[model samples]
Target: MNAFEIIGGKKLKGEIQPQGAKNEALQIISAVLLTDQKITISNIPDIKDVNKLIELLGDMGVTIERLNKDTYTFEAKNINLDFFQSDVFKTKGGGLRGSIMIVGPLLGRFGKAAIPKPGGDKIGRRRLDTHFIGFEKLGAKFIYDSKKEFFNVDATNLQGAYILLDEASVTGTANIVMAAVLAKGTTTIYNAACEPYLQQLCKMLNRMGAKISGVGSNLLTIEGVQKLGGTEHRMLPDMIEIGSFIGLAAMTESEITIKNVCYPELGVIPDVFKKLGIKFELKGDDIYIPSQKHYVIESFIDGSMLTISDAPWPGFTPDLLSIILVVATQARGNVLIHQKMFESRLFFVDKLIDMGAQIILCDPHRASVNGIDKKYKLRGISMTSPDIRAGVSLLIAALSAEGKSTIFNIEQIERGYQDIDTRLRALGAQIKRIEASAPTH
Candidate 1:
């Protein structure tokens, strides 16, 4: 394992660039399998999860070329269908939550797909029933193996039909749409997830000759096509990273400029941060956060305590709630952080409380934070990161704290944020990665 030893009390004051969206990259990378032609993708993040997915695609005989650090060309001309049934396939596809998406394209083109039980952050119970259920609705036969925790779907001929998803799951919607694009007829998906990632996916699919309407709404209509062609796609900036940077600038009292944010697509992220009284200016596509002595948390109109909560897209995202909770620790006044989607995500407040923040863990899903407003800096202490978002929150807290802090299990953070330590270092933050010796049994 590796750990980050951070020297706190550094106010970062430089320009940092947000990498390509990780969530979108997962969907787009998997979409490469939908076509046999060469597709070029720009702004792909070099993160652990994405690289794992890319490696899996290569193993399946996708011709992949690296044009640059952030660019790649993929052509799925000669896929090995027999490879999906191998033991190596189980190990490769079972470890990533994003691997579930491959099922859509494989079933669309090859008429069958199989995947082991997927793995990801243990923040909450992430169910795969939505993906399977959507596939079943699209004329695919779904089977599950309880002993092996594996799932298989077979459909020789897919016929489009109307699907009302139980919930607006992001990956689930993307998977179904990818499958529907090559079906026989029209497919209507109600209550779909309309995140920018989904929008970009729809746009790219249209460019490839798939007919899809309702690009930025819950109701999406798709007319199945015979085949899809290759097209180049440039991913938007990572919205979660941008939100984290905004909170980092506020907590550390630093003036930082985030370049090339692709502002219009951010959708309610900046406004949500503004409610926390973080002062920022939007100059062209860059977000500039100015250093301030104190930022006061704003309450509701009726004088009730301000509550920052997560919901579906166009609402606050659950991913950034941890950053919001950590930022609230140093703001003026109190606020309630509610994480509705995931039950265990808010449990990390215990570590923050130990670090000298006044936090009340109301339950498994909600916490109340009383901001110190810089009356006293947080005292750094040793901690372990439970998940990706929480790890970034702890890193931000440590950066604004008083002394040295060590965060173990940084791999959780690296899975999402590309080159995090190096990026923070570029902004004048004192964070170092130390390699630890392997333990012998």
Candidate 2:
């Protein structure tokens, strides 16, 4: 096991280019299976999850040639050549949420796909009913064998149909879209997650000759194509990582610039931060965050405490709530952090509270943060990470706190971000990557 040890209370200043979205790149890489042609994807983040998915793809006989640190060219010509229950089922699909999507493409093209229950942050009971529901509507049968911990799927010549997803689940919509791209007739999908990730999927499908209308909206009309060909594509910059960078700059009161921000794709993030009293300058596609020693928290028009919450696409991302919570801690006024999507996301506040933050965990999904307002500074303390986002949030808090702090469970952080310690170090953050010699029993 490895941990990130931090010597707190240092200002972070330097330019950073946000990595390509892990979410988008994952699906784009997987969609390569739909063709025997070469699909070269650039700007892919070299993170643990991506590596795991690549490993899984390799076991399935996908030949991936790494062009550089950020480029991967994949050719799935021998698709299903190495099919085995062991190679596919043991993967932590539930964790990626996107992994469940493999069922749709595999079933539509290969007539079968065995996937284990996906695993992710135990934030809440994220239902796969929407996924199974959409696939079932498209004429795929799902066999839930809990004893085996995988979904046994089999479908023959799926037919396009009207699918009104129960909850507009992101991965659910993606699964249906993947399955429908090759189905007979037209597929009308409403309430789809048409965010950048889904948009990239649709775009790739379109390049492969899949006719898809409504590219960036909730309603996606996919004209099924007989077969999708290979096309070169690049993943979009991670909006969540950009949000993290924004929060980091605000906390450290450093003027830092974020390169290639994908200005239009970030729906409401810039405006949301402005509402929180953060100042920035957008130079073309790049964002410049200015320094602020004493930032005031924006209040509602009624002078009441402000509340920031997360929702589905076009709404704020739940992955960024931790960063927002940390930024709120440094503001001058009060704000309620509502994490509507995940039940256990707010649990990480305990670490911040111990470091002298004034926060009340109203419930599983809400926390009331009374800003320190620079009136009282935080003292550093050692803590263990609970989840991916929470772990980084703690690092941000530790960076601003006085003295020293150590973050355990580096695995969770590695699962999402790549070489985070090294990346932050480049920005002048004093952090050390340490390994724990003793194994957990």
Candidate 3:
């Protein structure tokens, strides 16, 4: 219920580093359950969703030791399977979308796993069918307890088989890969998600003695091993946060350097931002965005409107479409944002439109933005954050606005970004966290 109070029109400067990848942290952390030995993971982000997943693991009897602020050692030697049936498990497990990943590792190691219908951003219908269907294809029995809203999977013996996924779902592919790693035979997964995070998972599993090939492609091959041993993994920098900072710098006309961005692993993120006419230079592993008074959007060679859409790996990420949309508000041209993965992700455009951005919400999946070229500054207005990406998008918009703005429900932003207010403050942003007042009865 906390909010962010920001005095806009201040330019941010200095260097900010992106935290460890949130999506990768969820999968890598869940992979600890696949083995009984100690697994060390470094560069873990200090965020709500990742912390919740770690706490859930600790509650399930994993011996977790914090080596430092961003490093942890986890041992799953004597897990208490009985805890899965406890009420505490239902409540905690159901609250996090990442909790669904535990099922594959648990089912692979313990032969059974159950989870309540997971919760996350209400962007659209995020179906669990991709996950359960993958498990079922691998010779696991799937059960849905409709009355209790629980999903249960049990496999006495898992034998690997060919799986052609309905969609290249990242979490689903990770879950199925985790399960397939310990199966009895070779498992081939076609149309798998080939994002860098997923590739990182595959490489880490290979390091842990799981035979996996096709590390950076949509097709993955895994040879099931009898057991996996301990291994160490370091997560990549969060690309979503990196993209956010790039957009933030452009919108606020600030010169900001994003350090240690893992530039090579960012896929098409930089190119996509470049299409929007945002300029930056890659100095080794860092990205430096110089202050810009105006940026223009690029159109097609045939003079058609520039359309940026989300696709699978090596394409534009859906997570940053919100940032792109927000950045497009001040650019010097028009662009169409197509949020193909999630229907409601573009709904936040209303708040930006209220702030004086010329945006037309074509539908739930697409938005057309007519950049005012900074001719009219956006006036600050109170707004509520709808999701993590949208929250940060709004915060960026507020940073470039003409007056003070209040953004309620900042918890959504905190779930993904680590110490965001502190980081922005370090860059000379006029923003502060305001705690909610206690209710009077």
How high is each candidate's TM-score?
A: 0.98, 0.96, 0.98
Give lDDT tens digits, candidate 1, residues 204-319: 99999999999999999999999999999999999999999999999999999999999999889999888889999999999999998799999999999999899888888899
Separately for all candidates shown, the number of backbone clashes (residues 3 or more apart, or on different chains) is 0, 5, 0
lDDT of each: 0.93, 0.82, 0.94
TM-score of 2: 0.96
Model 3 lDDT tens row, 232-275: 99999999999999999999999999999988899899999999
Write down the RMSD of candidate 3 (Cα, Å). Answer: 1.7
- lDDT of model 3, residue 146: 92
Clashing pairs in 3: none
Candidate 2 worst ten-residue window by lDDT? 80-89
Q: Which stretches of candidate 2 lie over 4 Å from their true place?
A: 87-97, 437-441
